[model samples]
Target: MATPARTTQAATTRPVRYAPHLYNDDLAPVRKRTWGTYSIFALWMADTHAISNYTFAAGLFVLGLAAWQVFLALLVGITIVYIGMNLMGHAGHRTGVPFPVLARVSFGVYGANIPALIRAIIAIAWYGIQTWLASVALVVLAVQVFPGLSPHTTNDVLGLSTLGWAAFGFMWLVQLLILSRGMETIRKVQDWATGPLVWIIMLFLAGWLLIKAGFDISLTDSLTDLPASEQWRQSIAAVGLTIATFMTLILNYGDFARFTKSHRAYRRGNLLGLPLNFSLFALASVLTTAGAIAVFGEAITEPVEIVARIDNPWVTLVGAITFIVATVGINIVANFVSPAYDLANLAPKYLNFKRGGLISAVLAVLVMPWELYSNPVVVNYFLGGLAAFLAPLVAILLVDYYLVRRGHIVVDDLFTDETSAAYYYRRGFNPIALQAFLPAAVVSGVLALVPAFSAVAPFSWVLGVGIAGGIYYWRSGRVRTGPLPNEVIACASSSSTPTGSTPAPS
Candidate 1:
């Protein structure tokens, strides 16, 4: 949790004649920062309480580790996430700027779009996958409620059934409607009800499964007997995989963190939400899955599948809806809002948040994520290849903000292309970032795409981050003329807008 020096309030918040190409109301410094610790906690709840996480958590149990070992891995992994998110969020909290805007400090005014578009494109793909996942729950509810709908469940169009398409469309529209309302609505829904409801539903499901299992669930029996060294290696890999799962959200944490009220509150919320909350959820998920094995004679990893087996329409309806809500929570925050900011950063003159969200939604459909999700090869090469770029970008941003710039951001320069501006290096592009990014991205991409390198694919993020950060730090030395002027540093540190001090207007 490095507390970067704050950009001056007047420089960031006061009205300035910023170029239309680089500035918009949504991308501008937040008018007020009022999100408290609980809100931040709920944000993680929304992010992690998803269908994917439920399945991922359960899958970790079979990774040749004991139940306690799995929990230990989860704690270690999420703690790393907690630390990374805090670091990413501090910049946003200090400057009241979104991720893409803050990115301009390192990537240059226009170069920022490179990372922005990459993140947005990846998020759009995930948005579709999550939308499809949520729609599956809806389809289950529809068939259960209307037995007549069974015939339509047959695959008819583009590998999706008529009912599936209808359900998907309905869910897609519902999410868009929610997103169009604004971030405030998103925060309230996720914080007040959606996250807690999932917890209650999951707890109920876990309790029911426990009763059905006669309290004889085994969390570790399925794990294969392996050498202690092998188990330790596997446990470490599990931790890496857990951290890798949140790579998308970690990169853009600043999008939500900009609204947080204080560093202390932000850290407290992250501590509570990430490692603590996820550990609790992991316990419930692992127990529920283990219970499924005891009763159903198989490890039922999918919560929807477990609900479907209950032989009660009411339970099915309630469980299906809860899964949908959980998926929706993650989709909007993790997939939808990120691309909205990223795409808006690309062309702020024309694309506001709502319009950007619309564009993302439409493009998600065009990607036909069912095809992508269903095909393992495509999932490996296509999505993985794009994702390989994220680590290096993360490294560059962190290195530039904390190291190269010494935690100083010239707020005005981020929006301007003037030759004299601090960030206007080599025509709105930082050659060092490009130099650092390309090789790291290439190596990660190779690891993701090459069949022979599959064994080491999981470590691509660590490799990319280390390589890019090192290169950027090394290359910056050549271009580093001197430290910023004392007055600039003083203005940033003495900014009137203390971190998260202002109350948001009602």
Candidate 2:
């Protein structure tokens, strides 16, 4: 095991020559780690406070479990996510590298691109879906405010109506503008604007529904007609699904954590953002769903649908706009940022952050995510498949960082293409890591896709994580406790050896 080195300013401040094929400003260690507790807190706020999250929580309530049972599941599942996020985040905070760059330690400098592309593809799918979701809210508001637009909503073109296309285009443009401004601008927007704005709207909507329903809402009331045994089974399934929902973020959490000032700050933000914030959001979702049922005579799971049913046009408009903002916020943080860094890592010489983001955006549009999201069967298969691949990757990463390497990565070797460098195993690829990832991912994918293993499908993420982590751990042989090779203790101790300097050829 590599010994943990002393924290050093030289890691960030020293000037080191980087291989042209391996370095870019976006992939380098951050010189100024400006993010604090609130930034992380707000990041989760934006990520969790979205239409999809609201609907997912509301859908769980309709599974016939008592409110407390669902909450218990949420608490447990989110707690696990909290722990995972901390592990991933701490690595980035300590190493000062983004997710893809960090992966080079385990996956080999070049092999890391495989996982990076996989993650980037998933992000693109999500980016399109989220962008479409946000647009729906705008379409709803536009048709309500201007009756003339109703025709355009029904006149279909390329699977979407004219109004839908317009809304999607508008949303796509807005997100592009924000992303072009860079990560700091995104952090500021989430922290000060979208995060707080959505919370207020959610609280207000829940209160209004409660008051309108005559305060008769009860979480204990069964919403589904299923048998009690099946309800419990479904409840358990919901726990897994809930975890799967955020697995992507949990895996790449280091992307955001690298910007954080300290481990404590990251944990503090996660505590507020995951468990506390998510619990409150879940409660609001349940209450809002129950209230909608009582008043509307049917369960309205979608927030946009609920808002549309409101008699007050002004209030409805506000709700629509808020949902748009919330969805956009989540899309940028959860989907856009991950791929931007991942794709940029693929070819640092050619692609910078902005260019990578643009590629992702274009691919998102080409995929026509609206079609994928509109069909429930497709959405399930797509998300399940994503979990299958992602699960093993997460497991491998955790094992490599926490167990094998012992949280000690040679910062300079991460940017070197030389065969002698620690990360450049076998011509810049680690066959061991690939061997571990492939079979695990294949088995997990089979479980998700095969009907015989359908019952086990929900737990695909957990299963993958376990299988991959175990395989990597066992295959790597006995753990080593010696100090890491080429480890830089601190900036002051080793100013001569810059963190980005290229290593001599083997």
| TM-score of each model, paired residue for residue | 0.91, 0.92
Local distance difference test, each candidate:
0.80, 0.81
How does candidate 2 fare on TM-score? 0.92
Off by over 4 Å in 2: 1-17, 225-228, 488-506
Best by lDDT: 2
Model 1 residue 160 CA deviation (Å) reads 2.8
**Candidate 1 on 1-506: residue-level lDDT in tens?**
12222243323343223567887778877776668899989988888888777887788775556667777888999999898888887777766778998888887888888999989989999899999988878887888788899999986798799999999999999999999987888888889757787898899889998998888866556456877898788778778777777777778988888777777778898998999999889878888888887888887889988988998878888888888888999898889998999999988888989999999999999999998899998887765565478889888988776777655555655666667677778888888889999999999889867989877777777888998999999988843333454212212222323332222111
User: What is residue 489's positional error in candidate 2, in angstroms?
Assistant: 6.8
In model 2, pairs of residues that clash are: 1-480, 1-481, 10-491
| lDDT, candidate 2, at 497 | 31
lDDT of 2 by residue, 174-272 (tens): 999999888899999999877788888788878888999899877677776778788778778877887787888877888888777777889999999
**Candidate 2 at residue 468, lDDT?**
86
